[model samples]
Target: MKILVYGAGAVGGYIGAHLIENGLDVTFLARGGHLKNIVDKGLNIVLSNQEKIVHPSYATDSLATLKNVKFDVVIVAVKAWQVRESATEILPYTSSSTLMISVQNGIDSPYELNDVFEARQIIPSVFRGICLVSEPGVVSVPSQCSWTLGEFQKNPTRAINSLLKPLIGSKLQLKVSIDEDIIKDLWKKLALIAPMSGVGALTRSVLGVCLEIKELRNMIEKAVEEIIVVAKSQNIILPDETLENSMGFYRALPYSATSSMQRDIEQKKPSELEYQTGAIVKLGKSNNVQVPVNSFIYYSLLPQELAARSDLR
Candidate 1:
């Protein structure tokens, strides 16, 4: 399988490293300083509990050089906002049977990429591995995280299994979920991440701190309820116990931990916020759903984000 792992930031880089470690056929698509580092020093991953050098892989920035190369799978790991640009740029790398996997966060990314290509051409999967790029080629993820795969249409057929075979058991836990209502599942996830990322970025604090504040806890519940209403309207049933379960795990996280979105916002780097909390507000308005908590955080964080960006210049 000729796999082209796009973006190679944290998540993409981590996945590529694992695939290469397992002796799978994979090449990284990266740019800028990350591209240079990968070309010169190869890729690196620092596990949550271990020393900072393990998996390795080759990388490059040239799509034209890989023009004749037909990738059996194209893992689109960039943020949602970059889907359009990435698709356009990498158009030549796709072939008829190329499985364009959407391993990004947010409900719209898979759909967004689908519109650019075809819905059937996309393999929608939720990756729970925690990854953050402290530098260009250095990627980090917790050792024991899991990844779930399912088609948007509910059937991860034989073809899907063939594609997932290489990634199944080598260092990453893979499961197949036959949930036809993936939209609801994505929304449920968004419901939690929306508030967590928003609050995390706004406060420069981790989830534990937010959970400690009575007011913030109410805000999070309120946001989840709003998302639940939207999910129910769309005919997706989410268990009432889901929120409590999510909160339990969230609060148990290390106090110093922060969302990748929060890290991007703090670093003044362009982030997936548009696909994170921003998507909720946008979708909520379109569906006549009110997401005040998310809206407040989205707008409030904008100025700080803008100020941070200005300092970069």
Candidate 2:
């Protein structure tokens, strides 16, 4: 089966490298310096214990080169802000039979993918890991994290099975569940990340640091509560212990465990503020719920995010 991994950034590069090591036919969609680095030096994944380098079957910057080639599966591993552009680029390479997987951090991506392709053809998933692009072609994944996948609605027969069949024997941890469970999964992740992201970025602190600052920790809890209210308004109810468990995660994190969003803001790079904390504010508005803390955080970070994007341009 031919697999196309759109955007060979940290998430895509890490996943694509593993698939290549497991002997899968995978191609990466990259651009400019990243694409050149991959062609010249191949892709490298550095971990705490070991480093893996793999030259994929093909790596190119242009989608036009892939005309008439139908991919069996297309993994959309771009940032939430890049999803729309990546979807448009990968459209020509997909046929009606192609399966699409969205591995982004936000909750709105599944619906966004449905706009580009059929809902049935899209599988939504949430991933956990501390990964980043250290350089042009080198990606780092410091931790091993599992992936949770499901359709927007339950399907007796899912394309996820076929998509994951190739990596079945590998060490990839993939969990499959029904639609309701997946919705809960998304909300649960949001509950953990939205607050962590808001507090982390706003305070310019890591998880451990936030744990020490009472006010920052309180802000994190407020963000979680607001998100829970929004989730319930949408009929997605998480467990009663969700908030407490989420807080426990923050408290247990290493002193230096910084969130990706926090790191991006500190480095003045574009962050996923829109879909992470911004989503909470939007949902709260629509649900007629009050998310004062999240609103403060979102608006506070907007200027930074906008400025970073402008600078990149």
lDDT of 2 by residue, 1-313 (tens): 8999998888788778877877889999988887899999999888767787789999988777876799988889988888887788788888997878888887988888888898878878777656778888988766665566676656667555554667444333222233437767888988998898888898887788888888888888988998888999999988999889998876655677877778888999898899899998998898899999999999999988989989424
Q: In each prediction, how many residue pairs overlap at the backbone (N, C-alpha, C within less than 3 A)? A: 0, 0
- Model 2's lDDT to the true fold? 0.81
Off by over 4 Å in 1: 49-57, 154-159, 172-181, 303-313
TM-scores of the models, in the order given: 0.87, 0.90
Highest-scoring model, TM-score: 2
lDDT digits (tens) for residues 82-185 of candidate 1: 89888877667787767787777788877777667777777776766456777877776654555566566545455656556776664533233433455666
Clashing pairs in 2: none
For candidate 1, the 10 contiguous residues with the lowest summed lDDT are: 172-181
